[model samples]
Each structure stands twice: as structure tokens, then as C-alpha cells.
Target chain A: MGDEFCSCDILHENLIEIVKKKMPQEEKLYDLAELFKVFGDTTRVKIISALFEAELCVCDIAVLLGMSQSAISHQLRVLRQARLVKHRKEGKVVFYSLDDEHIKTIFNQGLEHILEPRGFEHAVF
Target chain B: MGDEFCSCDILHENLIEIVKKKMPQEEKLYDLAELFKVFGDTTRVKIISALFEAELCVCDIAVLLGMSQSAISHQLRVLRQARLVKHRKEGKVVFYSLDDEHIKTIFNQGLEHILEPRGFEHAVF
Candidate 1:
């Protein structure tokens, strides 16, 4: 299986060179991966999804997802650290929302990939 | 910490009701998180980034990323399973490219998020 999938020879060194030059710095890519890892959790995704419709407090997110407020708060901290979601204080209450439109766009783009029909036959690597 | 961050009361039942009605089914959200989880890996993100530049064979990808052919192949399989990437056979070599434009858009959106400056004060909650 490995032999069939991976050739020892560099098939296209020219293309590789070009791509290498254009690729983002390793540090940036690492940060990008970390950012996606934040979204990779079910609880955080639910919080972001709920916030997509309306700004939400921790208690509200917990209620919406049928989870405890403490659990919701933990995920909110992750989201905030990644800067995917931000919060505002209204007196004693705090409302959390997507930091910007890019969160919604990123989520929708993934949804599009999931929703789109596959054009090619599934290959076993 | 928990008390300050998470209120016991449902602050916005009306807003929760609206978001609840509009939220995608839980199963769909689960699938969405799974898709993001695929993007969370550094190797997979690097592979996707390279493919963004041009379609290339596994060996080419392995060369560009300075990783072993077997490691690249493993990541390729995960990418293929998630439908984030597609492969085509050209004679004896197999070339992989992103599954669609959505993949690029998703990656770019994440990039935008990382690049954008935080507008709000970082909250501790």
C-alpha cells in the first residue's frame, strides 16, 4: 500500500519549489492549525453556531445547547482565546458573539464542502 | 470563577428560542466539528496549503513539506476521507488537488481570522 501510494522519486520538483516559496511560514501555519483546533470541538462549534443567530450569554448558550453554564463558559474561554468569539458586558451580564464575519464564512465554507456532492469515486490510499 | 462567568438563570429565553429554532440539527453540527477537526492537524494543514498552490503527486507533496512519503500518504488518506481533497491518476502517478474551491475559501477565511486584529479587549471569562 505504501509503495503504491508514495514514489521514492520526486515526481515534480519544479512544482514543489514554486509551492514551497508561496507557502505561509511554518509558524503561521502552526498558529492556523491551532486556531482550527479550537473550532474542532463539538461544544465550541455549538456555541459559535448559536451565536451565529444572536449574541448570547453563557447561561443562554448553555440553555440553548442543553448543557450546563459552567461547561459553556469553558468552551467560551477557548473561543475567546482563539479570538473566534468575543464578549460584551451589559451591566452584570456578558454576551458573547462571533468576533467577526469570517467565523460565519469559515463555518459556511466547511458546510458547503459537506453539502456538495462528491464528483469522484472514493479511492483507498 | 465559575460563578462570575456562568449565571444560573436563563438570561435570554426569547433569544435562545429563536437561535434554537434556526440552529442546524445537532447531527449536522457534529459533522461540522468533525470537518474542522480534520483541519486542526498541522501536517494536514500543510498538505492543504501546498495543494492550494498546484495539484501534485504524493511524492511531490512529501518533497515540498520535507516529510516522508509514508507520513504524507497517511495525511492524504485523512484528507481524502474528509472530502477536503481529491485525487486523480495520471498514468502511473497519482495527483491530489483540493476537492473544490470551498476548501481554499475555508482555509483563506481562517487565514483572515488569524490576520485580522482583535477589536475588543481580551476578556477573562
Candidate 2:
């Protein structure tokens, strides 16, 4: 989208102009990449999946996932720092859950695609 | 769910039961992570964002992103491998676009969370 004088034009100019105007800025792209990076781990995804159904404390997550408490806590801290999960204190215990609808939406939508992709399933393979 | 008798119980048993029931299997979790890892790169995220707006060929993408054609092709290959994008040939030229609605949904939803977080934005810092 730099200018009208660049050489490549595989798409319609109007469409290219529109896309250039709407495309995310570099910083936003970086943040977006960073956000996905948090989700790009098996342990973290599992944690988010577990929290999708209900809130759970660190100990509970460890037990459910069959991981050590310290390891679970480390991943939770990453999720917490990324604002993917929220925690509330109940006495000495802190429980965690999906931060908001966005996490669930991302998880559920991605899953929907993985499990059921109308016609594109063939292209994926 | 592993069993009915694990020690930690910060949440209701019924809720734990449900999350365990719904949680993705290990293979799916690994796949999910792999899918996201592809998104975790800034150049790749920018590529997807550009595609989100309109389909374009490698030369156009390289020009638009101020990157080399080889670099753009490399990321396009990665995106192709992850099934995040699709391509078609028109004689000597090939074009690419977001594979399906899943990518669009994932990108839009994540953007929404980042731009407007219903008062939870503060926790992200």
C-alpha cells in the first residue's frame, strides 16, 4: 500500500487500496503475534481449555492436568501477564478463569474450524 | 477425566467433571499449539492481516510489506503448511488468501479483545 507507482498488481487496485487502508499497523501486528505466542504452547492451551468450563485454583489445575504445582503456576503467570486469564482470591487460594469472552471465542472458533471446515477441509490436507 | 478421586477441589466436582469431559485430547492440544505458533511471528501475522483484507500474489505481498519476494514466499509456505492460507495459479502467477472463515474469525476476535476489553485492559499491564 505504499503508493500508486509500485510495480506489482496481481489484485484489483481498488481492492488493494482498501486492504492497505484496513490492514493492521506494524505495532498491532507485533502485539497480535505476541498474543498468539501465549496460546502457542500445549501446556498453556490445556490450561485455558480447563478454565473454559470452570474456575480452578493452581492446585486443582495441577491435579487435573497431572503436572506439578510449580509448573502450573509458571504457565498461569504467563497467561495472567498476557491478560488471558483472571484470578480472584478466596482466603489463601486464588482461582483462575478465562479472562473474558474473547478467549472462549478464540478457542471455540478455532476448534470449530479444526473439527468442521465446510469445503476447505480438502485443501487443508 | 482421569478419575473421581484426585485431591485438589477448589471448584465444584461437577464443573471439574465437565471441563475434563470437554477438554481437547493431547494430540489436539499439540496441534492447536502448532497452529498458533505459526501465528506467533510478526511477519506471518502481517501476512495474514494483509490476506484478511484481500488476496494477493507473492510479489505484491513482498512489495506491500517492504520485504523480499523470497522472504514473503517463505512465510507463505509456512502459512500454507499450517493451512492458514490457500493459493491458486493463474498461468504464470499464483495468488494467496486466507484459507477460510476460521482465520478471519480468529483475527477479528483477538483484535476486538485488544482494542476494547470491557474494563479488563488494565490487568494486561
Candidate 3:
């Protein structure tokens, strides 16, 4: 698959046409990359799931995840910065919830894909 | 935000209610983390964007991104294994496209979040 991927075969006409018509700008590509990077963390994803169904404060998140309050706080900072979660203050407690539906959409979709009866991601074995 | 997040304050009543109702299982959290991790790479994100709009062979992907066919092919393997993209062969050329629509939804949502008029990810961010 390696060298073959670079093989000097004549280019496919359809591929060439599509590339010319649909190529994205470099900055948009970079932005897309950064966005995915935000999702790539284990702790963050768990935090996201915890927040998916309810708004939670740091202490609440910590307890739900079986993590320390300090740990939940750190990840929440990352999530808040990524715009994956938003918050409001009630007295001194900051309640965090998913910023939008995309988190759940992506999560559920991925889950569905993996859980498909056929296999996990086209046969992990 | 630091120490306060860990303060021994009694948990808020609403928070306890939500956490109890919403906490996810551990294995699901791990799987969710793995899913997000798949999205968290710059090169992979670009590859995803390109495929979002077109079915591409390795050479084509390399050309569109000004990358080596070898490099694009490497990333394609990762994408395929993750089930973020799928491929088919026509003669000797293998073409790749997104595995499904989740990639697009997630990407578009992140773009919308960051590009919001007020600011990015909570002011500066």
C-alpha cells in the first residue's frame, strides 16, 4: 500500500476534477485540524459525556468521573477554552454544560459506527 | 479558579441530582476518549476535510495538500483504521473518502463555534 499509493500511474480524471473544484483553503484546513485536536483527549471526552446530560459544577464533575476536583477543573478549563462547554455561575459554583449539540452528535455517531453489527470500524481484527 | 474548584464546599443540590442522573459508564468514557483522540490531529483533520468534499486517491491527496504520497498514505491508514475514512480500489488506484457524515457535522460545528461573531471559545479564546 505504501509505494503503490505513490505509484506513477496516470491520474484518474474524476479525482483530478474533484480536487480542483473542492480543495479547501489552507487556513480552514488548519482550523479543522485544531478543532479535532480538542476532541482527542480521554479525560476531556469523559468530561464531555458527563456534561452531555446535565450541567455540572467542578465538584460535581469530579464526583461523577471519580476524579479529583482539581483534575476536573483543569479539564474544564480546556473544554471551556475549546468552546466545547459553556458555564454559568450560581452563587460561587460554576455550572458547566455542553456548549451545543455537536458534542452529542459526534459522540453518538461514533458510538453507532463502532457498535454496528457488522464490525468496529471495518473490522479491527 | 484553581483552588476554588477543589474547595471543600458542600456539593450543590442540583449538581448532585444531575451527576447521579447523567454520569457515563467507565468503558463508554474510554471509548469516547478514543473517538475524540481520532479527531485530534492536524494532518488527519486536513485529510478529513479533503475527503469531505471528494473521493481521493493517495497521489491526489498528496498533490492537493502539497505533501508526499508516502505521507498522505500513512495518514490514510490511520484514518481507515479509525473508521473515519473508507477506501475502495479501482484497478490499481485506491480512492479514499470519509467513512460517514459525522466528520462533516463535527467539523462544521467546531467551525461555527470558533467563527461565532462575538469571539472564539469564550473570549480569546
Candidate 4:
């Protein structure tokens, strides 16, 4: 199946050279993949989506997500470690919010991809 | 560890209610995570990055990434399955490119997150 779809004898040498030059460093690409992996989990994605609405304490996030505070906390730790979220202290309570605006932009971009009409379904395979 | 950081006795009922209303459906969030998971792999990310430069056949992508054609084809199949890439047949060669511009925007957003100075590193823990 693989060969049938992509066994062209002639490689596009010029195109490959250009793309290789433009490709990010291998380490950067690995880090980028690691960052996206943080978003791949449902729990973390929920935490991120909730943070999008407003900053919230762990208890609030747990209640909102209908999950245990521990479970939410675990995911929050992962998110914080990835720097996709940051916490602020107000008196005794710690509130979590997105690390920066770029997170929201990234989430919205992903949402747009899934929400948009996927016209490629009918493309020749 | 979890409790120390988030044992606030009072849940923010009002905030939870508001965010709950604004939160996307569970199915949508699940789909969103699945979509991001497709981008969470190093090979797929490289494939997407290459397509960002120019459309190319599987063999070209294999050469550009310094991977076997079979490996590149596998990742291309995953990308195609997720609708992150679309392919066209020119004669006998199948050339692939990003499904839409949202992919590039998404990649840029992720890039910005990693490239930006993360001020949250110094945030109070």
C-alpha cells in the first residue's frame, strides 16, 4: 500500500533541499512535539479550555470538570511543567490561567481545524 | 503535593457555572485533543513542516527527512487520516500538502509558545 502511493522513482531534489533548509532544528522539532503531546490528553485539554474561560483555583477546576481535585491537580502539574499554564496566588488560594495569549491562539487554531469543513475527505487516495 | 497547592475549601461556584456553560461539548474537546495528538509526533510534525515549505511526493518527503520511504509513508497516512494533509495525484506521483492554512497558523502558534520568553518560569509556585 505504501509503495503504491509513493514509489515515484524520481525524487524532487530541489524541493527537498529547500524544505530541509527551512526545517527547524531537530531539537526544536522534538520540543514542539513534546509541547503538543501535553495538549493531546483530554484532562489537560479540559483544564486548558476551562482556563480559557477564566482563571480558577484547583477546586473550581475540579468542580467544573466534574473530576477529583487530585486528578485535575495532576493534569495541572503537567500543564504547568509544559508552561502552558501558570499559577497566581491570591491570599491562600492559587489560581491557574493560561501561560500566555499564544496558548489561546493555538487552541483556537486547533479548534478551527476540527470545526472547519473538511473538504479533503473526498480527495483521491 | 496536590492538596498543598489546591486545598481551598470553597469551590468558586459562580465561576464554575459560567465556565461550564462556555465550555465546548465533550465530543468536540475529545476531537480537538485527537487532532492535536496527530501533531504530537516528531515524524508527523516534520512532515507538516516540510509541507509548509512546498508540496512534495512521499519519496521527496522521505529524502528530505532522511527517513525510509516506508516510514514517511506511514506518517503521511496518519496525517491524511487526521485531515492535516491532503494529497493530489499528478500522473503517477501523489503529492501532499497541508489541508488548509489553519495548520500553518497552528504551527506558528506553537512555535511562538516555545520561542517566546516564558515569563511564567518565575511565577510564584
The whole-model lDDT of each prediction reads 0.83, 0.80, 0.71, 0.83
Model 3 lDDT, full chain set: 0.71
Q: What tens digits encode model 2's per-residue C-alpha lDDT throughout B1-105?
A: 443334456445666677788887988888888888888899999989998877898877877787877788899999987788889998767899888678888
lDDT of 4 by residue, B12-91 (tens): 77777889999999999999999899999999988888888888888888777778888988889989888888899988
Residue-by-residue lDDT tens digits, candidate 3, B40-98: 77778778877877777778777766677778788888778777888889887788888
Comparing only chain B with the true structure, the TM-scores of all models are: 0.83, 0.77, 0.78, 0.83
Q: Which residue pairs overlap in candidate 4's backbone? A: none
Residue-level lDDT tens digits of model 1 in B1-125: 44433443445667778899999988888989999999999999999999888988888887777788789889998889998888999787788999778878889889888888765476345
Task: Give the number of the best model, judged by DockQ.
Answer: 1
State each model's C-alpha RMSD to the native. 3.9, 4.8, 3.9, 3.9
Order of quality (DockQ)? 1, 4, 3, 2
Write down the TM-score for model 4. Answer: 0.86
Q: CA shift at B121, candidate 3, in angstroms? A: 8.8
Which pairs of residues clash in candidate 2, taking residues 3 or more apart in a chain or in different chains?
Answer: none
Model 4 segments more than 4 A misplaced: A1-10, A123-125, B1-11, B120-125
Q: After superposing candidate 1, which stretches have Cα over 4 Å from the reference?
A: A1-11, A123-125, B1-11, B123-125
Q: Across all candidates, what is each one's fraction of true contacts kept?
A: 0.73, 0.62, 0.60, 0.69
Worst 10 residues of 4 chain A by lDDT: A1-10
Give model 3's DockQ, 2 decimals: 0.51
Q: What is the lDDT of residue A85 in candidate 2?
A: 88
Kindly list the interface RMSD, in angstroms, of each predicted candidate in the order they appear. Answer: 3.1, 4.4, 3.4, 3.1
